[model samples]
Target: MNLPELLYALALQHVPNLGDSTARKLIRHCGSAEAVFREKKQNLLKLNGIGKTRIANLQHTAHLKAAEEELKFIEKNGIGVAYFRDQDYPEKLKHCFDGPLLLFYRGNINLQKKKLISIVGTRNITGHGAAFCEELIAGLAPLDPVIVSGFAYGVDITAQRAAVKHGLQTVGCLAHGLNQIYPKAHRKYMAGIEENGGFFTDFWSTDKFDRNNFLKRNRIIAGLSEATIVIESAEKGGSLVTADLANSYNREVFAVPGRPGDIYSKGCNDLIKSQNAHVLTSAADLVYILNWELPSTERAVQKQLFVSLEPEEEIIAEYLQNMGKAELDLIALNCKYPTFKAASVLLNMELKGLIRPLPGKLFELV
Candidate 1:
């Protein structure tokens, strides 16, 4: 977007009562944000969901003034701006009904043709949770998926650091703005994170750091990814909220199960019990559920090369190859192996790229 269009979009975003969806509606109706300002109040009111009060709010001069100042900040800092209607806007996020109309970002972030997943959990992470989060990212390194999180403490930082360690891009969706980093201590990790990915937020530099900002920021974390994974969450926490948001968007949600009595495990356990999220045991589960497969050429070459598998894995693989496709229990029963053992073998084969998993617990030789 040009300077004038950006200015109008910023001004429209500055309107207090006019939310992202309504602003988008008005922009679509008026052809442009610049045109929306020139539209008659009576005509804007005629649009469904736009009230007289909202039109009156749009008439305020203060919004434009604030937007002008924000534009100056963008120009001075070399910050990147993405308008919702532009091709550069996040494609997955575009599907979100309440996604930000404009996003301001800083860093060398790229999402094109990249697998994206958001990992979120409680700020007070447990040792097991941290280990699981790190291992999950490391295991997923082969897929080179983009890791997104809030850039907060505990699970968020753990996941991002693991992403950087694995040479994967990681995006930190901040609750505030690029002007500052929350938790203050995480400022040290910023350089490494920006080297591959960077921070994103819709809040302006001048916006205050409020507790409520995190809830609004959670949507971006959930919306930016193809799936949202909860490493660990308490019964009531922001991570659970993000999971809910991902489900609302009709995207996949995964949760790491904990012992029934564990405090941090309650939320994830609840989500799984309620069928709101899939049981996430390892990176293989995500790859399976998302149907992410290696290139057909690569699979064909691997299959022809006689790649080695464990004796048990070979038994399951041989069954799958002959049977076409089979579910977990069926494969175990036909192979005369225990169901738990068969599940583990399938996951290993998936990680090795020797087999592909389908929906409904089905597996087939790649």
Candidate 2:
């Protein structure tokens, strides 16, 4: 959009309590943000869901002044802006009802035909959870998917770092404005992430930093991806909120299952029990469920590797290889392993890409 149009849109976005959905309605009805400002109050009131209270600040001079200042910041910092109606806006996010009217970002981030996966979890990440987050990214690296996260501590940072290590794009969604970085300790990662994938936010440079802002930003993280994965979450946390947002968007939500008694695992276990999220034991489960196409070269290379299997996993794989495809119980019986033990081994084999699970609890070599 032109500078004049952006100024008007930003001002409209600056109006207090004027939500994105409502803003979109106004823009659609008025033909443009500039037109919305010129529209008569009586005409705007005629639109459904528009009320005096909601548009009370619509004509405020301060909003336009703030927008002017923010525009200066955008110009000075070389920030990229994505208007909701524009082609450059994130395709997945545009479908969300409450998506940001204006999305500001910085870096060489590219989403064209890219596979977007979001990984979220507790800021106080456990060692096991961190390992799993990294391993999951490593496993999915061959497909060259773009990793999306909140850029917070724990699972978010772990996933992004793994993406960088694997030479994949990683976008960090920020809670605050682009003027500064939160958790100041992460300032070091700015250059590297910007060099590849960068940061995204709807907040302006002048917006106050508040805790509630973090909750609001969760929608962006959830909406920008094809699927959102929860590495580990407590019974109540932001990651759970993100999962809920993803579900609301009708996107796939996956949670890493933890032991029933573990504190961090309770949220994931409950999500699985309630059927709110798919059980994410391995990256293979995500790939299979999403039906993402794997590269022929990577599949060929994976089949050639035969290392890193435990004794039990090797036994299950051998049984499946010989039988072609055998029921879980039959494999357990033939391998002299307990049913539960055999199931665990099969999961490990799935993680290693050695075998795949079929219908009716059957197993077959991948």
Candidate 3:
């Protein structure tokens, strides 16, 4: 977008009641943000869902002035800007109904990766949670998946630091503006994070820091990824909110289970029990559920041809090979195994790269 268009888009974003969805509606009807301002009120009122109250603040000159100042700050700081409709915007986030109208970013970040997962959890992370967060990232390193997090304390920082250590690109979704970093203690890690990945936010430099901002920020963390993983969470927390948002967006959600009596395990356990999230015991679970296949070269090096399988696995494999593709229960019944036992065997075979799972509970040889 050019200077005038960017200024107008920013001004549209500044209007109080004109949310991202409404702004998009106006922009599409009028052809552009600049054109939206030039459009007459009567014609604008003819459109659906555009009420007087929503556009009441559209004519305010103060918005333009604010946008100009923000544009100056963006130019001065060399920050990157992505309009919602632009090709440069995060593809997954663009599908979100309430994604920001504009996103400001810093560092060498790339949103085009095929496999992106968000890892979120409680601020008061337990030692087991922290260890799991690191181990999970390390295990996922071979896939070169992008790690995204809230950039706050506990699980978020642990995941990002692990991503950096594993030489994987990681994105930090911030609650505040690009001009500042929250929890000042994390300032030291910024350079390392920016070295490979970077930060993303929609809040302007002048926006106030508020607790509600974190909730709003949660949407971006969820929207940017193909899946959201909760390493740990208490009964009530922001990570659960992110998980809900991910589910709302029709994306996959996974949670690491803990003992029944543990306080931090309550949220994850509830999600699994309620079937809102899949049980994530290791990276293999994610790899299997998402059906992510390694590159041919990597597979050649990692998987041995004619490798031996357990007697039961060999039975399941022979059945799938002959059947082409079979549903879970059919395979179990034909092979004389219980449904649950057959499902577990299928998962292990998938992790071993021996067979693959299909949608609708179907399985087949690789």
User: Which number leads on lDDT?
Assistant: 1
TM-score of each predicted structure versus truth: 0.86, 0.86, 0.84
Q: How much is 20 displaced in model 1, in angstroms?
A: 0.9
CA lDDT of each prediction against the hidden true structure: 0.90, 0.88, 0.88
Q: Give me the runs in candidate 3 sitting further than 4 Å from their true place.
A: 302-366
**lDDT of candidate 2 over 1-366, digit per residue (tens):** 789889999999999889999999999999999999999999999998989987778978998999999999999999999999998899999999999999999999999889999999999889889877876776677778999999998888888888888899999999999999988998888888888899999999988999999999999999999999998899999999999999999999999889888889989998999999999866667877999876655444454464777777777777777889998778878999745456556655665567767887678997
Q: Compared with the true structure, what per-residue lDDT tens digits does model 3 show for residues 304-343?
A: 6787798988999889878999988799899997454566
Worst 10 residues of 3 by lDDT: 295-304
Q: Model 2: residues >4 Å from true position, as ranges?
A: 296-366
Error of 1 at 44 (Å): 0.8
Stretches > 4 Å off in candidate 1: 295-366
Candidate 1, pairs of clashing residues: none
User: Can you rank all candidates by lDDT, best first?
Assistant: 1, 3, 2
For candidate 1, the lDDT comes to 0.90
How should the candidates be ordered by TM-score, best one leading?
2, 1, 3
